[model samples]
Target: MTTHLITGAGSGIGAVLAQRLLERGDDLVLLARSASRAAELAASYDGARTVVADLADPASVEGLDLPASLDSVVHAAGVVELGAVADLGVASWLEQLTVNLVAPAALTRVALPALRAARGTVVLVNSGAGLTAHPQWSAYAASKHGLKALADSLRTEEAEHGVRVSTVYPGRTATAMQEKVHAQEGKDYDAADWIDPGTVAATILHLLDVPRDATVPDITVRPNA
Candidate 1:
């Protein structure tokens, strides 16, 4: 059975993805900021193990102890700070980047040994914002753009080492993050326009379901109007 490590497994798409993976009979490792939430999720997923760590904190990431070998890593942890470029605070900007970009890359680097050993896939949950800029979304766009670059670089660097990287550009997923963005907008964004989190998880599973001789570098899953 494949062992999958998923970050941000406490809520939103991350939680949904974890559920699908668990049902598929994969051993799971859930990493999240809140231990209680992670524990609850773990309990729901056949008592899977939980690791508590803040991805934004470098020391916390560096201190993680995972299995000696991992079949895959679904990097579902991310953050969003909405504001015009001028109004976005430097500190908040860094925090967003830390969680959305730096932490993923750093975590991937740390998990390299185990991933390479298992020829594992790294699933990066990027966003449409990374591909197209929008007003009041400067920080999110920048972080996702950086994350896309990281995925590309890792794919090239790790292929020879037998590890594959997959970057997912999903548009307006019906997640808590999306709700937060909509709530702050003073209007209800069309939930009908949102992509199903389960569908996204299935797409990710497709990326890993490929033959060992094949590789899928990138994919865009958007809700069609």
Candidate 2:
């Protein structure tokens, strides 16, 4: 059975992905800022375990005690702070970059040896903002764009190590984060207009199911408008 470590496993896409992996008989190591939620989810599965780590904190991420080897690592934890460049505070910009970009890179760095040993895959959960910049999403867009770059670089760098890196750029999804974004825009949240988190999880699973010789480096999933 493949062993996978998933960040942001407490809810949304992360939680859905964890459940799907468990259902398929994969062992899971879940990480989240809230220990309670991660612990609760781990308890429901026989071989599942939980790790409490605040991805925004570099020290915390660096200190993670993960398994010696893992078949996959999913970096799904992210924070979105929306505002134009001029009005966005430096702190907010840094926070967005830290959680959305830096943390993933750091976690992947720590997991590199294990990934190499297992010929594993690294999945970065990015967003549509990574490809296009919108008026009020400067900070979020910048971080995601950076994340896209990170994934591309890793794919190239880790190729010889037999470790694959894939980035998923999903459009607005029916997640709590989407609700917060809608509230900030003074718009009502509509699940119909967004992609389902399960759909995205299924896409990741498909990527994993591909032959070891084949690699899908980037995937873009958007709602059908």
Best by lDDT: 2
Global lDDT scores for all candidate models: 0.86, 0.89
RMSD of each: 1.3, 1.3
Kindly list the per-residue Cα lDDT of model 2 for residues 1-225, writing each as its tens digit: 799999877678987998899988998988867677766766766579887778778568776788888899998889998887889999999999999999889889988988999999999999999999999999999999999999999999999999999989999999999999999898988988999999999998987777898999999999998
What TM-score does structure 1 among the candidates reach? Answer: 0.95
How many clashes does the backbone of model 2 have?
A: 0
- C-alpha TM-score for every candidate: 0.95, 0.96
In model 1, what is the error at residue 96, expressed in angstroms?
A: 0.8
Put down candidate 1 lDDT per residue, 1-225, tens digits, no spaces: 799889977777788888888887888988867777766876777858887778878558786888889999999878887888888899979998899998898888888899998999999999999888899988889999999999999999999989999988998898888888998777788767789888888888899788999888889998987
